[model samples]
Target: MKSRISRLASVMFIGAVLAGCSTFGNTFYTASYTSVSDAGYVIPAIPTEKIPPQYRRQIVNYATNEAPGTIIVDTKSKFLYFIMPGGKAMRYGIGVGREGFEWSGTARIAMKREWPTWTPPAAMIRRQPELAKYRNGMSPGLKNPLGARALYLFNKGGDTGYRIHGTPEWWSIGKAMSSGCIRMMNHDIIDLYERAEQGAKVIVQQ
Candidate 1:
């Protein structure tokens, strides 16, 4: 198994070299959280260990011409791929806007906040009266909708009022379940928030 990881690491390194004209494909590597000792090509990240089983599948072949800082959100597949050097990428499972909340096209990471306070919009409040109490501002914490981090979205000249943020709900992955913002599992979001930079270009493809 160790030999396999080393081999994969080498292939990943090579992929970085032939990046411009690269081909990509994916394979499943799912195992329960408690089992990893026998896996042949595991990436050994914390998410693979703690994330729920259903959220572990990653898309390995999508190619992007976007630079290192670009974020491509595939709403239909519920996957978010972060471009890496050498024509490789680190993919994360995501929870996107529910039916009416879906959005697409290009945007940029306008601002980022750790433990962002959430304030429900007037529409949400009217739709769900229980949220009326948070019209002012909801403290950032485990209970808050934004979870641990937030990547605010903006177009060329202004905020879209939409964002890519974290959520405590891991099971929501692959489900259209946010108020338009792209949501990632808390564990997954923190990993992304740390690697992603402010002003990164984001493309939401439906």
Candidate 2:
């Protein structure tokens, strides 16, 4: 009985040591996602408390044929899925284009930018002539429409003039409002920008 007790104590000690090592290593494992803005004097995370609970970011069991790392945007559900290994995905609430401005199809991320500039397209300027001043492109900053980061989309033809971008208007998430771009919370976009490669596949589903 004494020998058994001693062996048990030894096993417990080894378990404790292994647990300690795991804890120590985890301290250095930086979180890939955060709410802090990637630029502009460290903007605070969006006031998620005010945002509806349904629109909050979450991990979900998502069944799909697409491979891991593909990005799928479902306009009807207003959700974006970052496919992960296993039948899971990191899902984020998103704001998509309004009815007339909605787009659908496959595209690749042609480029990425931190604090990208915003230039009102000539077509937009034609409708809102007051925006003509920014036709040359607005400089990147806090007030820029592109927010903290942007993933520019490209198709077979060329630049689609569409993007998966950050927006300061966090409340707009899960709503249809943008002209055509997919907008995420400023904090969420920064996290995505880090994971999404330049040539990553992006599918917009109407």
Candidate 3:
């Protein structure tokens, strides 16, 4: 009995040490995705200038029930909540679906990609045929629709094509401006990318 207890304690101590060392290492950080002059980002400096000054109040409190791994999107409230443990949350401003394309449901993150290629959906192409020209693939650069990262949502085996991606149109941050995809400022999207995992749960509330 004494030998067994000592062996068990030794294993438990090793596991605890490994977990503590993991916490000491940084898991993720923002990449310097651009050079000095080529980048076109200007959103963070003037939040009021990019988005409506009225939404400032909504931006501050940023409450949520989402745990450290859950994503809760309140489309009506125009806020995306990344739930943190201990009753705290990291909230972000989002632009939801446009007039005729709003949707709500639960989905799992099927995959994640950094600086993913942009491929506009056929419906978007139908609405604006001008987009047909880029059907092949848009390389990762400033003008690409999926700016710094993309979190693809899935229900069952189907692709919703409703990505949470970065956008050049930061002025529409708090508006119903996209055909269906949720848009976030590049920096904010980058921030979100760091926290999201491949199989994270997402709840989109209408």
Name the top lDDT candidate. Answer: 2
lDDT of 3 by residue, 63-179 (tens): 555557788888998888777776656667789899998999989889888778998888778989999987887787767777767899998868887899887676777899887
lDDT of 1 at 37: 22
> What ranges in model 2 sit over 4 Å off?
1-37
TM-score of each: 0.74, 0.81, 0.72
Q: Which scores greater on lDDT, model 2 or model 3?
A: 2
Candidate 2 per-residue lDDT over residues 59-160, each given as its tens digit: 678999998899999999999988989998777789999989999999999999999989989889998999998989999877788988999999999999
Q: Looking at candidate 3, what is the lDDT of residue 169?
A: 71
Model 2 TM-score relative to the real fold: 0.81
- Pairs that collide in candidate 1 are 16-86, 98-176
Model 3 alpha-carbon miss at residue 104, Å: 0.3
For candidate 3, the lDDT comes to 0.72
lDDT of 3 at 12: 99
The better candidate by TM-score, 1 or 2, is 2
Q: Is candidate 2 or candidate 3 better by TM-score?
A: 2
lDDT of model 2 at residue 52? 58
